[model samples]
Target: MEGILNILKPPGMTSHDVVDFIRKIYNTRKVGHTGTLDPDAAGVLPVCVGGATKFVSYLVEQDKRYRFEITFGFSTDTLDKSGKIIKSGPVRFLKEKELRQVLREFEGKIKQIPPIYSAKKIKGKKLYEYAREGKIIDIPPIEVTIYNIDLVEYESPYQVLIDVKCSKGTYVRALVRDICEKLNMPGYMSMLIRTEVGAFRIEDAYTLEEIKEKKPSLQPIDKFIKLPSVHLNKIEAEKILKGQFISNRHSIETSFLKLYDNNGKFLGIGVSERNKIRPKRLL
Candidate 1:
C-alpha cells in the first residue's frame, strides 16, 4: 500500500476516478496519480500510494510513449473526436512519402499550442472552464520535444496511425492538429493509447478486475525512479534520517540520488548539490 501501482486505466473513466477507486480499494486517502490522462483515452496510468505519493512529481516528469490515430476530414473543438465538429472537408489521401515528411517536421523541439478544451490552467482557472463559459482566451504556445514519431499505418483517405515518444507536456492531439494544418486538411485525434510512461509500460499494467481480486505488486521507489543511488553506512543513514547534510564522495552527476542504507533498505531520496548530500524526502 506504500508503493506504486501500474493500473491500466480504461477509457470513459477520468484519471481522478481511478485514483478514487484505488483509495477505496486500499482504504487510504494518500493515493494519487502521477499525471492526468484524458477520459476518452485508455492506457497506462501509474498510481502512487502512501509514501509513494511523495515521489509523484518525479514520475510526472518522465518521457511518455503513445500510439494514436488521426482521422482526416474534420476538426473538433477539443481537437479530438470527443468534441463537437467545428469544421469538415472531403478526406484526401496523402502518399506515404508525404506523410513521413510531414511527421519529420514535427520531430525535435517545436512550439505547440495546447487545445482550448484542455486541463491547462490560465489566470487561476482551467482553460476548459473558460471555453465552457463561451470565453475566448489567448493560449500561449509552449516548447515541447517530440523525441520520435513513426508512422505505424495509413488506411486509405481517412486515418493515419502513429507511434510517438515525446517529452512531458507534449499533447498528441495538438500534434495532430498541426499535422493536419500542414497537410491542408481537417483532422482530429480519433483514438489514443498511452503505451508507456517513464519506465512503466502497458504490458505490466493491471486491469481493475485483476486489482480487485489480487493485491497489486507494489514496486520499490528506488526501482521505479531513474536516478543515481548512494548507499550509506549506519552512521550516515542516521544522519540522513535526522535531516543532516552528509559529505558526497560518490560524485553523483544528477541533482538527486536514491538513498539506501548499509543493509540495502530504501531510505527515500536525497538532494545533491556542490559536494554535499542532504535529505530531500525521508520515508
Candidate 2:
C-alpha cells in the first residue's frame, strides 16, 4: 500500500479523478498522481502511495513519451479537436521528405508558446480561466527540448501520426500547432496517448477494472529512483533514522544515494556533501 502504481488512465477523466478513485479503492487518503494529463488524453499515469509521495517531484522531472495524431485542414481555439474551430482551409498533402524536414526543426531545444486554453498560470490565474472569460492575453513562450520525433504514419492530405520523446513541461498540443504552422497549413490534435514516463511504460500499466478485481502490486521505491546506493549496518541505519550525518569513506560520484539496511530494506534517501552523507528523507 506504500509504493507506486502504474495506472492506465482513461480518457475523459481528469488526473485528479483517477487519484480520487484510487484513494477510495485503497481506502486511504495517501495516494497522489505524479503529473497531470489532459482529460481528453489518456495513457500511463504513475500514482504514489504512502512514503513514495515524497519522491513525486523527482518523478515529475523525468522525460515523457507520447503518440498523437494531427488532422490537417483547420485549427481550433484550444489546439485540439474538442475546441471551437477558429480557422479552416482545404488540406494539401506534403511529401514525406518535406514533412520529416519540418519535424527536424522542432527537435533539440526550441521556444514554444503554450495554448491559451491550458493549465499554465499567469498573474495568479490559470490561462484557461482567462480564455473561458473571453479575455485575450499575451502568452509568453518557454524553452523545451524535443529529444526525438518519429513519423509513425501519414494519411494523405489530412492526418499524421507521430511518436515524440520530450523533456518535462512540453505541451503536445502546442507542438501540433507549431508543426502545422511550419507547413503553412491549419491543423489541430485529434488524439493523444502518453506511452511512457521515465521508467513507467504503458505495457506495464493496469486498468481500473483490473486493479479492482486484483489488488495492485506496487513497485518498490528504490527501483525507479536512479541514484547510487549505500547499504548500512543496523548501527548506521539507526543513526540515519535519527537524522544524523555519517562519514562517507566510499567515493560515490553522485549528489544523492538510495539508502538501504543490511537486510535490503529501503531506508530512504541521503544527500552527500564534502565526504559526508546526511539523511535527506526516511521511510
Candidate 3:
C-alpha cells in the first residue's frame, strides 16, 4: 500500500488522473504522482502511495531522459499537435552536419522558454490556467541543463527525432520550439516518450490495465535513495521518532543518511546537522 508505482502512462490521461486511479485501486487517498506528465505525452510516470508520498518532491528533482519527435511545417499554440495552428510557413532544414551542430548548441546549460500551455506556474497559478482564460503573460526563460542531446533520426523534409537527457525542469515541447527557432523554421512536437526518470525506466513501468488485473508488490522506499545507513537499537529508534537529535554515534560525514531499525526495517531519512542526527522524514 506504500511505495512507488512506475506507471507507463498512456497518452490522453493527465498525470493527476493516474493518481486518482491508483487511489481507487489501492483504496487510499494517500497516493500521489512524483511528477506531471503532459496528457498528450506517454511514458514513465512514478506514482507514490502511502508514506512514499513524502518523497515525491525529492524524486521529482532527478534528471530525466526522453525520446521526442519534432515535425517542421507549422507551429501550434500549444507547441504540440493538440493545439491550434498558430503559425505556418515554408519549412527549411539545415544540412545533416549543420543540424547536428544546432542540436549540440542546445547541450549543457541554456535558457529555455516554456510553452504557454504547459503546467509551469506563474504568480502561484498554473500557466495553462491563464492560457485557458485567454490571458497573455510574459513567460520568462528558465535556466535548465541538457546533459546530453543527440539527433536520433531525421526523416526526409519534415520530421526529426531526438534523444535528450536534461535537468528536471526541461520541457521537451519547449525544447522543440527553441530548436525550430534556431533553424529559422516552423515546427511542433509531433510525439514524445519519456524513457527514464532518475532510476525509473520505461521498461519497468506498468500500464493501468496490468496494475488493476494483477496487483503487484511495492518496493522499499530506500531502494533508490543513495546514502550511508545507520542502524539504531530500540532505545535510539524511539528517541529519533520523538524528534530528538541523537549524537552522531557513527560519525557519518554525509549531509543525510538512511535510517533503519535494529531488525533491519527501514525507518526513513535523517538529516546530519552539526554532528547530530535528526529525523528528516519518517515512515
Candidate 3, run of 10 with poorest lDDT:
215-224
What lDDT would each prediction earn against the true structure? 0.92, 0.92, 0.90
lDDT of 2 at 9: 97
Q: How accurate is candidate 1 locally (lDDT)?
A: 0.92
Error of 1 at 266 (Å): 1.0
TM-score of each: 0.96, 0.95, 0.95
Encode model 2's per-residue lDDT on 1-283: one tens digit a residue. 5799999999999999999988888888988898899999999999998778888876898899999999998999999989999999888878999989999999999999988999999899999999999999999999999999989999988999999999999999999999999999999999999999999999999999998999777888778988888998888888899999987866886888999988999988999888888999788
Instruction: List candidate 1 segments past 4 Å from native.
Output: none
Q: Let me know the TM-score candidate 1 reaches against the reference structure.
A: 0.96
Q: List the residue pairs that clash in candidate 3.
A: none
lDDT (tens digit, per residue) of candidate 3 on 103-193: 9999999999888998789999999999999999999999999999999899867999999999999989999999999899999999999
Tens digit per residue, CA lDDT, model 1, 1-283 = 5899999999999999999998888889999998899999999999998889998987899999999999998899999989999999988778999999999999999999988888899999999999999999999999999999999999988999999999999989999999999999999999999999998999999999899889777887667888888999999999999999999989787898999999999898999988899999877
Error of 2 at 207 (Å): 0.9
A best-first ranking of the candidates according to their lDDT comes to 1, 2, 3
